[model samples]
Target: MDAEVGGTSAEEDYKPESWYKVKKGGKAVPMQREERQPEVSGAATQERPNHFKRAAGKKLAEKSVGKQHVRIPDGATRIILRPQGGLAPLTRLGAARLLYYVCKETGIFYGDARRDILSPNEALQTLLIATEDKKRAEKYQQIASITTEEGSKTEIKAHMTIPESRGKGVIHNVHLSVSDAEL
Candidate 1:
């Protein structure tokens, strides 16, 4: 019989080799090949500004020297202090000086002056109050003391105290005070 007529030809029965082959244990393993990921260019890498950069920008803006002015809405009782000439950049000490002037002029005492008023260096304090009256200073101190005492008393009365057991194994009788129950 002729090869073309009686049976399949070599081209018709040919099978291409597979990329993977089955091992003796029946595990089909892939043939190893060299593969790599595409490289990224330096110019394509993007960077974001960090917290330091943002904070530096804010501080720079605040410290920019210029004519400082405050805009007050009509009918507002608050007095706005505006610097007549171009003011120097505000430093920590400068802020404290400004606060001192405001408090003196308005006769308003801001609580927690220790933090609000930067530690008054000798020169700054001298500049703050050129002349000091002993009577007035004493009166102000007395008022502050009275207010602090009253505030502490109220704060103490606001919280209720509960007696807790000293140890998990011991059961103790806790006597609640009249003030604690009222609270």
Candidate 2:
């Protein structure tokens, strides 16, 4: 068997023992052994742009820089509206409820209110923008004045009370006359 394996009996060729003895279909055949080459051993190669770094770059701290100072007009009363006492649902929901109330009080359309209520931050932003005109919508301070009820799920009950504008071309009387002491 050894003589036949080495090709001395006219079956195989003489070669080093390191050669492979591949068995196929119940028959042993001599085949050259494959030499293993050195592999690229280290971190896996990156195929895409610095995606990991880019993702981390987006996580950097955000900074806001600005100064806001308002000079109150003489004889103009300052009204400080307090946040209703209640079990505030997350800040987002509070914002939504606030927005819904503002739009309703301001006589905004239901569809517009719905859209604003969907995004509280945006609604609050809009409300802030709408209140910028002091002469039109002066802040009022009266116990009977509109306010939110206190409870776990507090809701808004404020009304938009704008001052009267004395001008002839003013075809619409959309202003309310609250006591100056309240303003």
Candidate 3:
């Protein structure tokens, strides 16, 4: 706590003057009550009362490591695809081909689905694989969307920055569980 008396410094304000002096002998004896200054604003204030989370939240705000948490709406069923590991970013033409490859590999009808694999955050952000059927989308989520580079056998699977773990961090039945993947 701070007692601001018309713009006084902290050190001057922290120490309170003696209220009165009592005379005991020929020479006057001054009686003063001393008080310990409380930690008002600084690291010590948080450490004393366990305001640890504030410091953690401040640190988190300072260093934003990656993209904001990607959340898809729940009105539709969709599977999110993101390039995994050190795989090179797919060009627009390559993205289109990969979308087709994923649909073909997953046994989904190309007509019933819609994809946006070459969006603004193509390399980091997730591209969605959506269909009218919820079960098919869920099934596709289970299967890893993989593709090989043009010449070499560089097998890449579609994964994402954040794992699809929700509800107590337990892996539940896909049919009954909820995830951040639905679009």
Measured by TM-score, the strongest candidate is 3
Prediction-by-prediction clash tally:
0, 0, 0
Candidates in order, TM-scores: namely 0.21, 0.28, 0.36
**lDDT minimum window of 10 residues, candidate 2:** 117-126
lDDT of each: 0.34, 0.39, 0.53
Model 3 lDDT per residue over 1-183, tens place: 555667974554454454456565656555576667785888777576566777788789866644453455444455555545433444443656666666666776765545322232444545555444666666567656455455322233443223235334555566645555751
* Cα error of candidate 1 at position 123, Å: 29
Q: Model 2 has how many clashing residue pairs?
A: 0
Worst 10 residues of 3 by lDDT: 152-161
How many pairs in model 3 have backbone atoms within 3 A of each other, for residues 3 or more apart or on separate chains, i.e. clashes? Answer: 0
Q: Cα RMSD (Å) between model 1 and the true structure? A: 21.3
Query: Of the candidates shown, which would achieve the greatest lDDT relative to the real structure?
Result: 3
Shift of residue 138 alpha carbon in model 3, Å: 1.9
Predictions: Cα RMSD each: 21.3, 22.2, 14.9
Clashing pairs in 2: none
Q: Candidate 3: RMSD over Cα atoms?
A: 14.9
Q: Give the least accurate 10-residue stretch of model 1, judged by summed lDDT.
A: 152-161
